[model samples]
Target: MPPAYVEALGSVAAVLTTFCWIPQAVKVIRTRETRAISLTTQVALSVGVVLWLLYGILHVSWPLIGANAVTLVLLIVILAMKLRHG
Candidate 1:
């Protein structure tokens, strides 16, 4: 396993990148405006995140697993909104 500080740093970075989707999600939720969002992009991103999550699970990497899990959920929410709104 990596050092404690290394894992901490990984977790910190993961948190930042993972939660960065919050603003987009909140905007979509509030405005119900997803016309500008690209279905292809969201689909690709969700698939990538799911793959990353699977990789992390197989490797037992907490940072990757946690980040990708949350990212996948956010992407799903956005994708669902896009489908519903558009």
Candidate 2:
């Protein structure tokens, strides 16, 4: 595969993954309640995202790093809300 194609695919994947969380974040923020959300799932996802971020950094992949970084923040916010409200 060409370098351009690889980069493009990576960008697309990153965008898709990052944007996928938008609805969840919005729902949580709007409702200001996380009672329905599972803490275990959020914790697992946060851990996974952190690992992905670390992998991206190690490989020097900007798209992965950026996307996972944003995702981690969003996840953290949701987790915090869950802990606070639940």
Candidate 3:
């Protein structure tokens, strides 16, 4: 395992990157304007996030697992919105 400080750093980085999707999610939810969103990109990104989550699980990396898990949820929400609104 890495040092505690290293893990903490990873956690901080994970939180920042993971929550960065919030603004976009909020905008999509509030506006319900998903016509500009691309289904293909969302699908691809969701798949990639899933894969990253899987990789994190396999490696027993908490930061990677947590971040990717949250990201996957956000991606799903956006993708669902895109499908519903577009």
lDDT of all predictions, in order shown? 0.92, 0.89, 0.90
TM-score of 3: 0.82
Candidate 2, residues 2-86: lDDT per residue as tens digits? Answer: 9999988977887888878878888887888899899999999999999999999999988779899999988988898888888
Best candidate, lDDT-wise? Answer: 1
Ranking by lDDT: 1, 3, 2
Model 1 deviation from native, Cα RMSD in Å:
2.9
Any residue pairs clashing in model 2, and if so which? none
Q: By how many angstroms RMSD does model 2 differ from the true structure?
A: 2.3
lDDT of 1 by residue, 1-86 (tens): 66998978877887888999999999999999999899999999999999999999999988789889999988898999999999
**Where does candidate 3 stray beyond 4 Å?**
1-12
Clashing pairs in 3: none
| Selected candidate, larger TM-score, 1 vs 2 | 1
User: Which parts of model 1 are misplaced by more than 4 Å?
Assistant: 1-11
